[model samples]
Target: MKKQHIFQNALLTLLMLFGLAACQDREILTIENQSPAIVMDLSQEELFLDSNFPDNLALTIAWDVAKYSQPTELKYKVEASADESFEVPYVMGTVSGSQRVVSYTVGEMNKAAQTLGLTANEQGSLYFRVSSYIGEAGEYVTSTSNTTMLTITPYELEYPTFYLVGGATAAGWDAGQAIPLYKTSNMSYIYTYLTGNEPFRFLGQTNWNPLNYSIDQAGTRENYRYFKQVSSNLVQDGDENMKFTGTSGMYKISIDAATAVQSIEVEASPVAGWDFPEIYMVGSMNGWSATAPLTMAQVSPGIYEIVTPLGADAEFKFIGQKDWGDLEWGNILKDNHGYSGYVGPKGDNGNVKFVGNGGSYKVTVNLKAGTYTIVSQ
Candidate 1:
């Protein structure tokens, strides 16, 4: 009976241990589970940034802490885009802590405006969403808040410096007579004028000796073309120079020397009073919503320019007066809007497509010239 009593006590002890182990396992699973949801509250309905606002002033946004099924370290990102679809959103702010707030100063917001291709002094709509991430080193789960709208006017940008030279240019190879072009606040280059099928080149320095650039291929302006050759010694014997192959009229010439590989653009020159006061871009890049168009800057009279993000085989078109008015333009089913240029009516303008890969490119469109060019930067 003593032995039997001892066995019974041992069995009870084992059963108790099993019960405690089961409870501990359940607790561990509960602590590791997560279910995060975005809080709906946003700090402001309309965010205004003006020249009078202190450059250092910051725009702060607060939201409810995202919930999780288990204990988690959350990382947050504030995104802004031209459309509510958030297809090509920009990460305006990021935080990795318990805080659910994000802030951007007047300067930071202005930079973001420039990034979204917003023109100076023009009001545009921006979509905002807060993304939350939960996890440790190797694992993560993400949730996003409902998108909010912000109407803002960005300050004008400080453009870049450019000069025109070459025998085809109006100055006719005279470096002293070379025409000077204005730079956008974003630092791209532009010059507007008339040029026949003559050849022209750009001078890095205002002189003929040091750096003179020309397109490596004639009649090709859709891709990167700017090439520098101090002398015939720099290139092989048969290398070609960039020239004006399109018809001669008012022309808006654009250049992107911001990167190591330079690019060039030549489009029909806009004729003042004949063309719309403003032009905007709408297509796959911006969700193709006619209501929201990316405004183009008039670098010179009749000449409009914009730097927009493009995707692989991206397609888009120019909208006159910011709506689906009678003044729409698109590719003519030939040359792909490169040299053949574009044509239009109102409805079914078709799409101007890009065959190249994706990145932000400098696009120039000439209203009177009825021509355009998309140069990779």
Candidate 2:
């Protein structure tokens, strides 16, 4: 009887094991061969961005819900291309499967337009689409959705160059000695000394003719200072010249030379004059050779610039002479010296730590502003 009971128990255990195996075989997950088409629609077909409304909503894109045979999460990447074939695409970002809409502000869309190489203040087509993926890496399926068109117009992000040439300025009407203003997208600025009773005007280049700028009238108001129109020594016919009537001192001159308007404003400056003949760059690039340092051309009174190849983590400093005996500048004077886009006048300041990949860079030093900038070319 005991043997019969043991045999029954053993048979029941074997049957339970087979049932578990069958359940495991049915739990397999299968991916469909083809991906469903993702449909996307835009809120606006044409986007005209305004700098004033940078934070305002520019556009919203909605897409159809992605479906799958089984409950699975989906990933989406927004791609933008200039052409339909998508030879090169600018990736916007990734989104979760549940997000069916994406929004772009005026600032964001404007940048996107610029990235697409759209001409400033001109209409251009920017093609956009989404790429959806299913499954994890090494085992995934990808699908591209229908293309959409956007007519975008971006604003100009840079301003034209301007030079100061006149009797009041140090250049003193000599086109070759004309001083260049530090230019930006919105305006051009210069901090220099000016004298009264002398007339001056702006030149597009070092020479005459072509592009010249002067006061619209004899005078314009700015607090206590005044730039009265000076009719004498006009480079071109009807090209009005202006003079500073205020007391002779250092002034901060800002120019707004847009296509629509030519404006100039003057104010007193607290900074001292920039007076340096020549500056040289001594760094790891030249094996820290002070005897044979790289020379930087003197662009303005105290401003110097140079274009040279820099390696990763390049360190350097500026000196008035090649041997670095006297005048020198490096990182700012602080307890822990580091990179801050500022240079100290003392020679003991820490080295200027370059934070970028190895490439050719345009190094600019503005002693008047007590700062420096490095831009990759």
Candidate 3:
């Protein structure tokens, strides 16, 4: 009897343990409603490249997830090739995410696609896919997101090659003449002229002012008129329709002949209506004022000229201020929108000239012996 009772008690205990474990497993299985679903949404279906960009470019992949119910981990796999089938992916990479929107860069894949002779807008395609995982006690469930495709295209940029004309290599200021803003069959071109502040007039032709002129599209080459200084509030394209708001001060610019300074000039002119103004020079070598200034004088009314002891290889720009409404303000003329020029050796003739409505100036610089690179603003 004692043995039977012990055996029965052990059996009952075993049954109870088994039942409790089964109930626990059932409760665990019912604890979570369902697994989360992840989704991906890319910003664009295609990527474009411009001539300025290399054959390979970086692409951005943005994605969004949905139905995320449980704490999940995500990983991304990008498979790309020249063929749509991706028989053999030329490029592959992995990423991880678990957020609603995840972003990834596809730079390596793009390069691999390019190596396969896949040009922009070609039939070749790149593919991307993502996988998500939800962890459980003993096992984890995985779900794969849909694949995304992107078509590559080309980008377009419109800017023409600018040319240089005349001037001394030693002098920083050289003349630039507009050869052709664009060589292609594009007719849309705008002109802008700039100048420092001062009172000066266009040289030559009394009625024809540097600030007076229009872009000529009909002619192959346009002649630029000289500039003279006169105190008048004239608006020009270089001003971007902004009125000259500067003080009246004599600013000067000096070029050193010994320094191989060939020529000194300014570019970008105000619109036609205003006269070139007078600008004086002030520098350390010139005592910092017009009175004690160097041999800074107006070569012509609008054009300030100076001869310096610096070598031809030296570089400097013309500085001055515009005189408007009794106040003197400084103005820094920009070349092709603030682009600097390449200065070369003196005695090498490469001069640039600017011939537009704003003003016509010549820059003669010797890039190499008997060789010149001229640019006109």
lDDT tens digits by residue: candidate 3, 193-241: 2233322212112222333221222321244321122123322223112
For 1-377, candidate 2 gives per-residue lDDT tens digits of: 99999999999999999999988876987645255546568899888888888889988887776566667678777777778888877776667758878888888777766666677799898888877776554136456788998888887754557778887776788988787776655466665667666778777788876766665542422221222322232222233566666556556676665433345777665433456777899998999999999999989877899999887779899888778675777875433255666555553357888866778999998776456789999
lDDT of 1 by residue, 1-377 (tens): 99999999999999999999999987775433244445455555565676566466556777777766666677877888888898777778777787777667877777677677676788888788887765543135467788778888877644335557765565677887665554433333332444555666666557764555555555534232454222221221223244565556545455554322345556553332325678888888888877898999988656688988787767787777667765566653323343234433344235787765677789898654344778888
Ranking by TM-score: 2, 1, 3
Clashes of 3: 89
Better of 1 and 3 by TM-score: 1
What Cα-based lDDT does every candidate model obtain? 0.62, 0.71, 0.35
A best-first ranking of the candidates according to their lDDT comes to: 2, 1, 3
Q: TM-scores of the models, in the given order? A: 0.39, 0.41, 0.28
All models, RMSD in angstroms: 19.2, 23.2, 20.7
Highest TM-score, which number? 2
The local lDDT score (0 to 100) that residue 310 gets in candidate 2 is 83
Clashing pairs counted in every model: 11, 1, 89
Highest lDDT, which number? 2
Question: What does the lDDT read for residue 23 in candidate 1?
Answer: 94
Preferred candidate (lDDT higher): 1 or 2: 2
TM-score of 2: 0.41
